[model samples]
Target: MPSADGGTTSLPPIPLALGGDDPCTAASKRTAERASWAQKSLSLPHAWKLSQGEGITVAVVGTGVSVDAPALEGRVTAVGDAGDDCVGHGTFIAGLIAAAQSKGTDFQGVAPAARVLGVRGTDERGTASVGLIAAGIRTAVDRGAQVVSVASALTTGKEELTGAVRYATKRDVLVVAPVAPDGETRPTDAPVDTYWPASAPGVLSVAGVAANGTVLRSADGAGEADLAAPGGAVVGIGPRGAGHFIAAGSSAATAFTAGAAALVRAYNPDLTAAETAKRLISSGPPTGDAARLDPYAAISVVTDGTRSPASAPEESKPLKLPVMSSTLQDRAMVVAGGMAMLVLLVAAAAVVIPRGRARGWRRP
Candidate 1:
């Protein structure tokens, strides 16, 4: 990956989770100073002038977030043992949402001034279940989180997780989640299917896209994605260290969309959770698959409160060509010009053919 200073370097990859018997991910000893391609694509510096996510609380529900992470110090609140991140995935997600800007690095969270609430959705080893993730959502709502970023995307537990999402919606809390789990977190042969909480109504389902605006993966079979954000080859801070880590998948995109939600909420304090989600979806530019998150536009664009067609995937219509009308005289002139050109070509060929044969077809 390239740093903000236009230098290239390698960094450790952060795993989304570990198997029950697998060891926890180690803390990264390397730091990447370059602004990740995601940061550049997001145009965060321009959006910062409008809103930095002040007075907002975003809950990260996953492998716990380490309170000691330098960029998130003094701004993170945890539920139970949620402050300890063994896999470093949750901390990395939290950093994407609200890590404060530090010296010597251009990398910063979408909402740098927002507060982070860490809620453990998985066990110490990062193994997650539907029940645990559902509980985490309800807990985050109880903790007064205005925006919840769910990192777990289970194929089952639709009934249970849908209820959890409804609970958050009733409280005016916006829930953002990945449409599918990261590739490494699920079985390689697993079929693409709906993930709970994200498939639930009123929840903002997000997919991941590379820096080039190409989707890294498709949304689950449930339905169309609400939005896409930078998730491929993304860089962020890890737990218990000043070093940075790289990760890719819709979970990271969900964190970014959650941060953008915070920005919208902070900027438009009167908007409801649904309204905030609508604002984000409406403001984003459609990329055929899903709307691409544009933080600056989400904050700056004024809407008439009506949903745009881009807010959801619609049945694509076939392109229709316009009806053409031409005068008979004009058509006749076009025909005459074609005939004149054809006659000139034939006359030239007739003059050249005999000369070429006489020269035994050799170049003159």
Candidate 2:
């Protein structure tokens, strides 16, 4: 039971505010069925190295979390109540990032093993302003969260939020931005119109998609979706604090993606926030109508490539595109020549087969 914006919350300010959801791993069986297949399948995303994410903490900036939820019972670092659960938004976002499976339920996050730092920025009214958003990001960074997940976005141009993002990126922390929901707008008519931190350079902007693997209404529609996760009327703890509700919007998607990042950083302890983020963005679910989040591949890349003795990539997973390499240009030419030769052969055969052509070459 936390208090209003300036008041004391029902739970204490410590663990309730910034510690990992301390649930027992033994009690919660893993539900990531895609785990084993993720390595072999380029399109399906999966989470691996569960326990490794223990020490890392994720700072979630949104409405706030409920300290006593089953998924987060003993795991809460704070003992007393910090405040009241006004809007249910922050709790759901936190649950997506670090909630455990509770005594009886299947909902969980990409990094169930990591900790959570809840930074409340919204009130009963709506989204908070740049001053609050900047303060939240800066506080989370100072508290040592390697990954900062901002499930909320700005509607207008703001200098302070941009500065906060720049500062966080410079510190080598992975900052996740959830694409704004409908109605949260700026005057520029641009979906990203300098929308403070999310549109600010250096932050990873995440978009939402439906469960049917569509970036729009359904599979038939087309649009830009970076990494899609479960965002439909997803079930989450409610306001009185434990009731359930079906929630939507990009916030849920952003939380899931951020949790995935925590999983990568947890497994590959040697990776800096930038390299970890790169691994996540580069290899996403390859086959869906919309992109899906990839946690395992990110860990593998950072672990094998950046960590250890720092050797060249293996033959099986060779660096195919070496970023503006001369070989890349040469390969492109080779592919083009092959296509051209095939087309020429087909055209020539088409013209010569008018009469007295070989049995195999006769036009149909």
Candidate 3:
């Protein structure tokens, strides 16, 4: 079985568990309580007040999603045998995208009202080729998916996958792909190279960001990361019978971005795929690596014409975003202190230069 992104295509490496046996060994740990943290971090609650990604369909093209998961109930439309996910990666991704938290828990997904079209690109053993992933994308598009989430990365370029991405984009479907999880031990047969279709053109590549909005993986220092999202310490359902998994990786980040896209699309149904992708990158707050996804800001950009769709340049053109710099902050703070001292000197009769913690003040 060739890895989709050239490394071992087993289950997504979910090693961080809040309370469980081993890292990924825990089968039934409920993480509903932790979902609020991620939601609040992304401001999903406020974004949902505007749109819960209603009337939008996101095709999760990865490991199959288990439809029977309690959090995902009534939110998934499995295409074929997608209801069964042995690796639980697909289900986890789907839960992030569209899990309905009707269970009165904090586990509400980014786009709880959105519909998830689960497409099983990988087999039971969590193995898939780039061609299979491409097929899954096309299938999701054919099934009326407005957004297509490609969870796997491919080491080698495949024309089929490229064509599939092009096909979806042509029809106004946003294609979101995450860089494959870094630091996982690659199989000896796996290729040592950058992952694709994330590296492919026309795909919205996302980098994983920790809760503090920092790029989680140091290797994401490449040009492929178009945007960043909260992927670290994410909580989502695994298979139906199994409990939740507190996972962290680029895959989770990609799902959150995809869910944001669904919300943007639902808010402005007429925006093209290029427009949506551009809005996400242009509206987000820039970190050192990439823009941290701001769902509310993106929606506001669309609704308020911060950058009108017509004014946006061609998709191939470069986007200039403001860099968040600590040096600039320090300089601003120093300038502010000097201004405050000047104001104090002007208000008082004399300049006060007391020092040494007021141990002794020399008379001038």
Candidate 4:
């Protein structure tokens, strides 16, 4: 997948196998305001009932899942060699996708209601070949993963990764691809120019924002960024240990948002993945370009058919998304300018701290 960064292509090694799991120190539950667009109104935190993503299975396509983590302990189902946690990348992602551990513990993920199916696609050494990722996508879809979250970059063949994305879409899977990291939107080249599946139509592409509840002004803010979520600061399992930290880029945001979607699915089991996505958007605070995703707001949309409105961007329109692939939508700029069907190669995600790797400590 060359990761769309024009970098080298090579697969890293897998993590060692773990037998089972236990509970980590859960964080203390404290009610606060539902801040992210994932929550529409100024609602109390810990107020919205978590759906537990009970019947929903969210497949995380990454290095692999940490089956023994207290959060995902008995919840992991692997089609591969039972997957491992070599880099702890999958553990962090899986944790976000479906970690509902005790309060006060630092080992919980978003949308703890959902179940996770880990498909080990990437290897250690910080490299994920295109073939491994694509295969992982196929496996996730086959395993009944309604929402497939891909955090790695297109490090090898774009065709292979895109094919895998298309396959998942054809089977009614909702795929979210994170855009590659660009150099802070250089004035010469457009910001949205880089990255793969994120540029793909059928797939939902995500970008990051800061913790102050403000989207990154440096972010291209092109039409591709459907909705922005807090990516700058978070608490999750990293290589060395855990603390209040920030994970950058659309990769982190995608996992967080995917967890919200899982919660929505848990709340309502019948909605199609697309419908679920739309419902989620309808429920969250609105941004001119598109409605940012909000878990709390979505609950209202489901239960009351009304959600809070979003703040308007300078000239952002009240996005009227349709049902077909956003690719074919006349108004939906799925792929801007010259990247109609470009696919990225194999590579590790740039602009990101793999949570455990040596070189991933960048924070701005």
Best by lDDT, which number?
A: 1
Candidate 2 lDDT, tens digit per residue, 225-317? 445655543444433333334445566667777877888777778877767765766556543533466666666643333211112223445
Count the clashes in each prediction.
3, 27, 5, 45
lDDT (CA) per prediction: 0.85, 0.56, 0.73, 0.57
Which RMSD values do the candidates have, in order? 9.8, 13.4, 11.4, 24.0
Model 4, span 1-364: residue lDDT tens:
1111112212221121222352222322221111222222223244236455677788877766656665566777876653555566666667656766544443356666678888866654334667777888898998899999887655236677778878987887888766543223433453345455665556666666654455544344543465565454333443223221123455666787787777777777776666665666556665545456566666546533432212222333565975686547655565543254443311234423354367656556
lDDT of 3 by residue, 29-105 (tens): 44344444567778887788888898999999977877777777777888888776666778878888988774435
lDDT of 1 by residue, 63-148 (tens): 99999999999999999999989899999999999988777777899999999999999988888889899999999999999999
- Output the TM-score of candidate 1: 0.81
Question: What is the Cα-based TM-score of model 4?
Answer: 0.64
TM-score of each: 0.81, 0.63, 0.73, 0.64
| Deviating ranges (above 4 Å) for candidate 1 | 1-7, 19-23, 184-190, 218-222, 305-364
Among the numbered candidates, top TM-score falls to 1
Which has the higher lDDT value, candidate number 2 or candidate number 3? 3
Kindly report which residue pairs in candidate 1 clash with one another: 3-34, 4-34, 4-35
